[model samples]
Target chain A: MLSKKVILYFILITGGIITLAPFVWMLSASFMYDGHANVYPPRFIPDIFTLTQYEVLFQRLDIGKNFINSLFLSITVTAVSLFFNSMAGFAFAKYRFKGKNKLFNLLLSSMIIPAQVTMLPLFLMLKSVGLINTYMAVIIPGMANIFGIFLIRQYVLSIPDSLIESAKIDGASDFRIYRSIILPLAMPILVTLAIFTFMGTWNDFLWPLIALTDNSMYTMPVALANLMGEHSKDPELMMAGSVVTIIPVIIVFLALQKYYIKGIMMGSVKG
Target chain B: MRIRYSAPYLFLTPALTAIFVFFFIPVIAAFVISFTDFDIYAINNFGTARFIGFDNYKALINDQLFWTSLKNTFYFVIAAGPLSIAISLGAAILLSSKLVRLKPLFRLTYFLPVVTTLVAVAIVWRFIYHPRFGILNYFLEFFGINPIDWLGDPNWAMPAIILMAVWKNFGYNMIIFIAGLQNIPEDLYEAATIDGANGWQKFKKITLPMLAPTTLFISIITMIGFFQLFAEPYVMTQGGPLNSTLSIVQYMYQEGFRWWNMGYSAAIAFVLFLIIFTGTLIQFKLQKSPEA
Candidate 1:
């Protein structure tokens, strides 16, 4: 029995180490000098840590601009989508409307259509409207997602109808009820959805790479990919760029992990 | 009275409009564009695009690179999908075990890669797979193995990406599996234990059957996600060393965005959609057949 316990812990700990080693190496390599990361025996610890690579990234490469771009886009998209999705979710949950169930079923079924199928024409559609390479190009596509709406709707459905009815009895306006009652009540799911949206928008690559043509418009992932194109030989510098790109999402995930994990579990619950 | 009726429509208008314009329209437009010859000239002048029925799909049938990417993508999905699911289930079992302590810490560590930006992690793995100076090779030397050029070798590249993908993704399904495991009634396990069942026996009998629905869900989602393999091969190999790591999406991206073969790319995207749709249907059918 004791031996079995030991074996279980051993496997778990070893798995943890293997999982963490690359991140540890990436962090360590980012602090090393150029070519230092390429040395024989592949140092997991920098012999002498310096901030030159980060300095190069921020000062020379001006990745901070891309950082700001990612920040603005992620926050804008998250905030807007949260509002839009919650309103839609509230309607789906509480209100009785003509064709509501059919409309929702249509939306739910269409989730099977991959986003890649829409990318080609979406780009052209945006370009035709002179929105290409703009922040709107990223934000517009992300403004409302079916999954976000579904998540919010699921959460909203659990709220008692008495509260909304009482609010209606008190002469609360429809928008007022949503803002005051539903939004506040749905705070937990909203935070969860917010984290998902923020992390998703921040880490997105292909769409941003396609939509944003100019370097200045690049999100962190797209910027990191661009950096890799020109600086594949410079692992240390690329690692620094990566560290910059990944840190925000990590911080966000770690901070609200309880909600994030719960969100995944909530999402995976078979309809 | 008027406002009462309009409120739901008011609430849904913004989201529904955005979805319709951006998502639904584009999907329909992509299908239409797939039937035409839309390229760089078409981008400049919409009239330059010609209606070419089934030409793009036919051309894809003849294209060597398309077949290579399709093969590579299938290879990745087949290998990585099962591997990741197995690891996820294993990890879920271990973490959910009563014997394991500090489960949250272990869970967090494993899940770190899932939350990190894929492009960043892929780049990090690219360096880690460095032939000579990489820690992977350095560690392998202790086992008396020679250094292999992981990303640079056609034979090794897909496997390398598969390893990284499995590492990156397993934690996600592990969380879901944990949730699924939690939903199983503890009395069934107790009944099995009282029946003189061993650990593996209990698992094979009670756990596997109970977890079937969760397994089905995980498999379908994992397969769908895996079918869209891109950023990893894009950043790590550029589908390199003889295009061994090339994926269908990467091919679509190259053809549509890079080469402006928009019609052909749309066809590729549709093919991917059809593949995922069919794959999902098959999983659903397979899952149902046992019960029937």
Candidate 2:
């Protein structure tokens, strides 16, 4: 019995260490001297811990600009997308539109169509409108995602019809009810959706890679990828760039994990 | 007078309008554009683009690179999908067992990878797989194993990506699997224990059968996500080491954006869509067949 228990602990701890090793290495290597990361035994400890890598990243490489660019894009997209998706979701959940079910089913069925299908034409459309290389290209698509709307609608369904009906009887305007009642009641899922959208937008790479051409306009992942092309030799600097790109999303996920995990359970309820 | 009837529409207008323009319209336009000879010249002069019906699809049949990427993508999905699913189920079962302590810590540590930026982690894994100095090769030497060129070697390139992907993704489905496990009634296990059934037998009969639906859901979603393998290969390898890691989506991106082969790219996207649809349908069919 003791032997069996020992095996389980050994397996779990070993697996856990393997899973976390890269992240630990990323932080450690990011602070190492320029070529020190490329040494024998793959130094887990920094012999000369210096801020030189970050110095080069921020001062010479101007990664701080890319950091701000990613920050701005993620926040703007999250705020706008949450508003648009929730309004539509509330309508879908509470109101009696002429073709609500049909419209929703149409949207749901088309979710299987890969986002790549829209990339070509959307790129052309944005190019034609001179929106290419601008933040608008990312914002336009991010403003309304089907999954976000679906998630919000699913959550709003549980917020009783009676509550909404009473609010209506009290002469609250539709928008007023949505603002005063629905928003507060639906805060849990909203935070969940917000995290999903924020992380998604912040971590987004491909669309921004295509949409924003110049280095100044590039988001962090795109900027990091761009840096990889020019500085493949500088592993420490590249690791620092990665740490900068990844920290914000990790912080967000850590802080609001309850809602995030709850959101997953809600999603799996349908499954 | 008729304000109530219009309010819902009003609420939906902005969102629906955005979806229509940015999503639905673009889908239709991609289909239409797939039938035309759209390239760099077409980008500069839209008027010069001519309708070349089915040419892109025809060209795909003859394109070696297209076939190579399709095979590579399928290889990735087929290999990584099952591997990740197994790992997720194993981790879930172990964490959910009565003997486990500090389950929350295990789960949070496991799930950290899921929320991190893919490009960042991919970059991190790239270094971790570095031939001469990577921790992966470093760890292997303790067991009398030779240092393998993980990313540079064609034979190991896709497998390296697969290993990193499984590590990154298993935590997600592990959460779902844990949820599924919690839902399985404890009475059944107790009842089986009274009947003198062994642990392996209980698992084979009760656990696996009960978790079939969750497994199906996990499998389908995992397969769909895996089919769109781009960023890993893009960042880690750029589909290099003799294109062993070239994925279908990455190939499409190269064709459409890099070379301006919009029609060809659109055709590739549709084929991918068709593959996913059929794959999903097949999963449903397989899941249902057992019950029937």
lDDT of each: 0.94, 0.92
Off by over 4 Å in 1: B1-3
Off-target runs (Cα >4 Å) in candidate 2 are: B1-3
> lDDT: which candidate is best?
1
Q: Tens digit of lDDT per residue, candidate 2, span B138-246?
A: 9999998999999999999999999999999999999999999999999999999999999999999899999998988888889989999999999999998899999
Which stretch of 10 consecutive residues in model 1 chain B shows the poorest summed lDDT? Answer: B1-10
For residues A45-102, write the lDDT of model 1, one tens digit per residue: 9999999999999999999999999999999999999999999999999999899999
Residue A208, candidate 2: alpha-carbon lDDT: 95
Backbone N/Cα/C clashes per model? 0, 0
- Single out the weakest 10-residue window by summed lDDT for candidate 2 chain B: B1-10
> True interface contacts reproduced by each model, as a fraction?
0.92, 0.80
Model 1 lDDT on a 0 to 1 scale: 0.94
Which candidate's DockQ is highest? Answer: 1
Among residues 3 or more apart in sequence or in different chains, the pairs in candidate 1 whose N, CA or C atoms overlap within 3 Å are: none
